[model samples]
Target: MASLWSKISAVLPLNEERFPLQFGDRVESSVVEMLKRSRRQLYSDSPSASRTLNAQVILDISWERLNTGTWRHVDKEWRRVYSYGCLFKVAALCRENPSEDEILQAVRTCDMSFLMGAAIMENILQDVVQILQSEIRKSAKDEDDSEHAEVKRIKIASPHVPVIKDQLAVPRIKCPSLESFNTNYLLPLKPVILEGIIDHWPALNKHSWSIEYLRTVAGCRTVPVEVGSRYTDEDWSQTLLTVNEFIDRYILCKDGGKCPGYLAQHQLFDQIPELKEDIRLPDYCCLGEGDEDDITVNAWFGPGGTVSPLHQDPQQNFLAQVVGSKYIRLYSPEDSDKLYPHQSPLLHNTSQVEVENPDAERFPEFAEAPYLECLLRPGDVLFIPVRHWHYVRSLELSFSVSFWWS
Candidate 1:
């Protein structure tokens, strides 16, 4: 087996040759020049002693700008700066004959979303993340000894949850042919519960995703977790935490007084490419009529009772339940008037009326909208048409992956 450093050490040099002193972009010429200087110092024996600190300062400033203020999906120049920061830190650490712990720690602590489409930086993250994954899997050898499985079905946090029954329910179909799905579901813009799909995922059988397994693999990795019950709540806020910290505090919390924490709507796959290997992007995602670049994959992991108050996405969605269950309610785009959408530009896609417990006095029209509901279980996928108003509530400790394509 080749070592991570042996495999990826040449990537930085190639990247340097490819992107030497790009000065005409929005990033100041001085900033690009600083990166060039840092790369040169990286070749020196004592890069960590001085250049690393300077790199960190620039990293902090770029990181602050990237995170604070209005959040945009893309900030080309800032992301490049952030990637430069990560590259410099890792290169310095690797050059110093640092332990594997040091390299893993550096990868976990830094934001993984570097410059988009930059294969050079991805090489840096991919090598470290994959190595950590294999190490964690190797540590689970004892658990797999008797069962012929990597992870046994450990008891989930939630009690046996009754499936939500509905008169108007989403259609359930087993792995329909691509042409059939395009005609019956895609072109018609209808929702369906697709069964017999994703049953063969390695994450389900070969690796078997469980709490203990996820913790072992990514416990130290930091992720943004929502600190309140739901995003619509006045007290709603987000904070950064490691997977272990989130699991202990949120998923296993017994105190009724504490607010629920949700690791919701995060591109966790990009951060932990290890998780991306466990599952496959469904072929149905290709059925969307939008550009291939429009597709976005996100992870939604959290405890029971976490709610996504009536909201609609701009793209078609395939919500796949990996562990535990969820109850989903969806209404057509025609019911937009009844949904009482928030007027603010930031939350304009979200609805003001709560789907389950609507205030009849305030939002009278919401009561009249007929909606289809479904109980999304493990190994199941739910198709949600673009602009369809939907509300989601976790029925138990859950790990779900959603693919959104226009």
Candidate 2:
């Protein structure tokens, strides 16, 4: 029943005298030397050396004694150094105005034993390193350019999206039969654009899904909306808002500078059953080995300039443009290595290189990657095979429904 601070204090004592705070190369060197000498004393069992191996001796060690050793000796020191270093670092962090929640999290999760060996110590070190790196990055300035006007210098060149010379264009057809679509496109893993396919959907009619009509149908229904220009941006966030609020803030407003609010990838039909009557699942989805109920129907509604970064999905998709237009660029699975996918877990499926504005210097291989581009209009259904990299940008205030099936 101890408080969080008390738990932290038990693990990492707050007494300034016991854990004297120090940092940088001096402290690192001292800790390394202390571990080396401790090992030597353990093997030698010299009485004089044993007497000198107290806390004070450990603190006042010289870097000359910290020499390289065998793998066995090196591994031991690595554990001791990390365990001892992390304790001091966390103690220092507590004094530096860290939030109570941060302190509580560390206390609850961290293994506090000074005797913990290399494995546990290594894990703790990884966590501490991440925390420190985040803090350092936050404190760093965005731009390093100097203010003095001794000479005018050209800025770093803006990114340029290269055109592919032999890009494989996705085939487009007008109202192809269900049997032809399955045999020609679905079975062969070929992408196709079906024109005049969703003309029968009620959403295509302006009166059915106008701002006023949307508000009347689902105004009070809470929906998760993404408030940002793009999810790749740092300032992007999601919040729950009413359909009416979304219409007012994003659909009706004329502020060009504000970030767009997008209601994307949500199952609106499930939330409001009335919306299910607006669209129908194409028979092409039935060609796969799943029932009609297995299909995931989601909506994407946003203003112009909204972007969906380059990413791949696990299921085949039919992106049907109900209102307005969108520009789409797709890269084949074979060119994945050339795309420079993000290393972070949160965005592993997304490409690090921007398609609209690519940095040639950092991602030079991207220039060699060929991609198909198209502008989708109302009643157009673009088929996206699973794992095909696609990036989308709204060319105008657009509303689209995507159907994904295995």
Candidate 3:
């Protein structure tokens, strides 16, 4: 409920003159300008005729980092926010030239700079913690002051029923339906290990995809670009051309290196043509539904160089691995006692804890948090309910797919 600006300022040492926390059009404009400048290639290379049409789809997503006011409207707010690297992927292309699948794949795959953004945010949190320490030290001598006395008060509720580590270790079983899962595990906000749900999906089966098939389905395929002379860098792009072109560029073509196994070309819906129409699960009577219908196909393409920091999804989700391997680290929603999610509507309000080396002094509750380690190989899908915190690491240039529905 406290403001991010105030909370961050309390912990980090900062001068109002240097880093003023203000929200207005100027800040929004700055973000717009930042995105525009970053898309230099897209403007220059993309065909001039379709530039306006293409730009229309570039929705002005009002994220807290870009617009503080938009964040304020959300119930939850987080301190220490910063964004680094390219926010969205863009590439150069000639006019009148139809956008190629390679271009689109490159754009999707290249939006990986979010990892760099995470590190920048951590620095901001460090500054906040330092400020809090200084304030505490100053109040140590003022015992009689009510403000000082209140600051000294610490709330440490005891756990009446200690949860055994072994008990928590047992993997959960998948319910017969989403309604059962919600009634059994969600209403109370408890975490459970799900089994068999992912094992039954066709995509998670033991079938190896062809080079051509993987490119069409994976969404983020890269195109090769020429280097000095011997080799060229990859020129990423996207277009809805025939599947044959996809295989030609990403599957069949070889650079100075070989393609990764998980990066194969595969079509998930080809096997289940009915899926293409229902790529995203539509609303069903039994399962509770969210406001939006756009909850079907949510996929992530983290190639050799991307990592999703510890964060949670807004809705219940089923993460199915189509190709490649990803090391998944998950924290349950109730563990929010430790992860510290923002009470905001801006879906991705995450805690500022550095998972690699959590500071016990700053986030003491993390000590009580339980974590689960699972490696998602091809065909293994992990079920993550809303608000469950998790982090992902691409083990070997992975390609993973997920299906989400309301």
Candidate 4:
């Protein structure tokens, strides 16, 4: 019986020990009675006779109270009871063949403490919703199977490359006047690799900006780091660690098995102001319609194999390679339809097709897109126009700075 209970516990999201059943032997009867009493109390005083009580309503009420700061001063026991009711509704909704007995059993086994159990209940609800949505989409797709099949057949035979006569390379320029840069690249909305611009920056010449030097200066400062090779991976997660710890784990102690960790697109200068003295804003950025304070600067530092998936940014970017080489690819906004952007809200701006090893069967349209590719070395800055799809992969342990402006 104990082993059976352990198997059930592993399968279910509930914690049996935290929520002991109130009625030991009469589990089904007690659950039914408790639910009836609770429902009556909830709807009894309501004036609207047609008011519909559902799991979503319970979830909304609980979420609003918890997230909107309304329950901050509420009694702890009352909040627990409300959270328990929410969990009960979620369990009832998630069960495959829900019955009064089964739902009550699940609820009774769930942890009743709101603070401890709410996250588990929420995750369970999300999983159930995703399953239901997937079924709905599958049913809809089956209805249009013939049309989809025809489309797939056409895509398989379609010519892969765009009609452009020749591949274009991003122009590389040494230090140019602000006027020439504005006219040649900035106004034309074309990308250019700029050299000699960052030659005067103190970080280029200073040993204080080196990896060991950074460990000594900002070692204790905690920052958010990405703990996966790519953000698109299921195992990707963010965690806070000190600079020295990140260096020790991802940068220096790199066993072949170490997953990529990136200190990416973070405003590290604001957090550790002492590090900002290493670099300066380019004169070309001042030509735009913004004050010096309006320019947003961010830092990107990571070990080799770190990837930034194909995504577009809202503001124009000048990505300066400070430490190591990076391979970059760009697609124009005109070819966005060919890129197969993700429909999900979290990755809407990102392309679904992997640039490195694109599956031809899945993303046939990608082959038709004209693109520009480059390899950026130290002191090279690449101009990326706003909304242009760009992907980056670090070839070596790298530190790069990005300046964003209108």
Better of 1 and 4 by TM-score: 1
Judged by TM-score relative to the true structure, which candidate is superior, 2 or 3? 2
Q: How many clashes would you count in candidate 1?
A: 0
Candidate 3's C-alpha runs over 4 A off are 1-170, 174-182, 192-212, 216-286, 290-294, 333-337, 340-348, 360-364, 404-406
Q: Per-residue CA lDDT of candidate 3, range 163-229, in tens? A: 3355434255643467776787656554454555445444444333423234333323232211121
Off by over 4 Å in 4: 1-168
Q: Which residue runs does candidate 2 get wrong by more than 4 Å?
A: 1-169
Per-prediction count of colliding residue pairs?
A: 0, 0, 35, 0
**Model 4 clash pairs?**
none
What's model 4's overall lDDT? Answer: 0.65
**Once all C-alphas are superposed, what RMSD does model 3 give against the true structure?**
23.3
Ranking according to TM-score, highest score first: 1, 4, 2, 3
Cα-based TM-score, every candidate: 0.84, 0.58, 0.42, 0.60
**What lDDT does each candidate get?**
0.74, 0.64, 0.42, 0.65
Q: On a 0 to 100 scale, what is the lDDT of residue 56 in model 1?
A: 78
Model 1, runs deviating above 4 Å: 1-11, 14-25, 64-75, 94-104, 112-122, 128-166, 291-293
Writing each residue's lDDT as its tens digit, candidate 2 over 1-406 gives 1232233344432343334233345346656555544434323434542433332344233212233453444444444444453343344334335564444333322232222223342344334433433343344343223411211111121222334334465678988887888889887777889988778888876446655456545654457789998899989998866676787688655576275889985456655555777788876787777998889999998877789999988899999998777888898888999999999998989998888899999999998998887878788999999889999988767789999999
Q: Lowest-scoring 10 consecutive residues by lDDT in candidate 3? A: 224-233
Best by lDDT: 1
Root-mean-square deviation of every model: 4.2, 18.0, 23.3, 19.3
